[model samples]
Target: MQDTGSTVPRRQLGRYLLDWRTRAGLTLVTAAELLDISHSSLHRLEHGQTGRIKIGQVEAACELYGVPEELAAAFTGLARQSNGKSWWHEFGDLIPRDFDVYVGLESAAVGIATFQPELIPGLFQTGDYVRALNRAAFPNASEELQDAWVQLKLRRQHRVTRKHRPASVSAVIGEAALRRINGSPKVMAVQLRKLADMSTLPNVELRVLPFRAGFPTGLWVGPCVILDFGITPAGSPVEPPVVFIEGSTVGNLYLEKPHDVERYHRTYDRIRQRSLDAVSSRNLLRQVAKEYLA
Candidate 1:
């Protein structure tokens, strides 16, 4: 059995399997028995600690869990791709189409360091802003569909806002992102004010990279997020860090290599260094909101 170099996809797949199993109301031992696997083996697979994921076993488990056809296919696809060092979830691909692998990763992450060059990070986006973007992105979609998308974004924000163990967020937003008008001026004003308010949260550290900080990295950097899982009591990472790069036209990229993660961390550090401090950023956000209101 070959070891999977990166655990990102495996972890994501495990999360999905676990969710399905729980929803099916099956105990771990019962589910393992139904899938014809040992309890320890099933436990390992559910924890993303298994080696050489067998596609057949994944399919059997999905079948045993009564997962839908599309979702079952998606899980199998993830199992097939779990051996790679890095995973690119193409927008057109079956796995990404049926399931959002990134959301699972984000939910499991303990801390996130993100740099956004174009738009407000999803965690900080207001409902109106999200609705506006969704309407624009899916112009032919129904209002109900748009509302669903908006609600999804809002739910994702709970990661940073929940009362218990909210994830730590460090975000550096480009000035351009703040100035860009997605919805009406009123919407922008509300959105900016929300950003300012959210920045006040103890777990969130928000900064803005002004226009004056021209090309801190000597090049244009696209939106990227670094997700760090918490460490164990022994001081070792619970799971490896992943760098998620959002591709506007193609698909999302997950980099799990040490070098790739380190490079993005360095870039994020440089960008953060050039950004306004938390107080200054909050001030700028309010000032911008006032300008929008005016």
Candidate 2:
């Protein structure tokens, strides 16, 4: 059960170090030499892979990279926050570093754009839907463990309904997601109804991509969540929108490069364009839910 808290701050810290080094035209070897540290250590520092960072090393980097006092102090601030603990640390072993980072970032995101091809999004999943999914997916696991997972899923939904400025959510779901029979028809019916209900919230938008639109090329990898953290604070200027790809065989992945973020944004726009409007999507959900109920 190892929880390294949110990786965002540390990753941000690493990113600044890298940016300053690049701006100063200092290579890994050059920066490491200036700081009297190994090139590998400098590389790791830039990637936020180190669990413990010596402040003296960072100070040396600030001097060599010619980082401004303000930016340097901000970097140090991120360094400290990166080491903060996770509130969900009780489920530490159950979470992967990448997924944990996504959760941490999601908690702080101002808005999220989600795309799903074959199943309900976690934020909107019902307890029964979650339990059934776990039961079918993890047949060997004890029911108690699966129940704990269901509770975890439920807790994650608080972000959408919290009183203190909930994240604005827009989900473009493929028709397959509506049609996929996860649990019993009853369970799915309940799930779809819940989705329609949630869609009415001012902060949530829902759409469905019918089969008529056809899937786009290079967009079928898997479901993804694109998170936007709003304006960059004075302290953190390099914080960019992130694209989180769900892994089929492993855990989640983060794509933060400009190109990666742009690619996902384009994909999201294209998919959204092809999907039914919010009202139409809600009608479709209700229609299908009636079929299940009937």
User: Which candidate number has the best lDDT?
Assistant: 1
Q: Cα lDDT for residue 284, model 1?
A: 100
Each model's lDDT:
0.91, 0.79
TM-score of 2: 0.68
lDDT of 2 by residue, 187-219 (tens): 999999999999999999999989888876534
For each of the candidates, the C-alpha root-mean-square deviation to the true structure, in angstroms, is 1.6, 11.9
lDDT string, candidate 1, 1-294, tens digits: 555667787888998999999999999999988888899998889899987799899999888889999889889888877865557888345474647788889999999999998899999999999998988888999989888888898999999999899999999999998999998999999999999999999999999999999999999999999999999999999999999998766778899888999999999999999999999999999999999988
The reply for model 1, stretches above 4 Å from the true place, is 1-5, 84-86, 91-98
The CA lDDT at 103 in model 1 is 85
Best by TM-score: 1
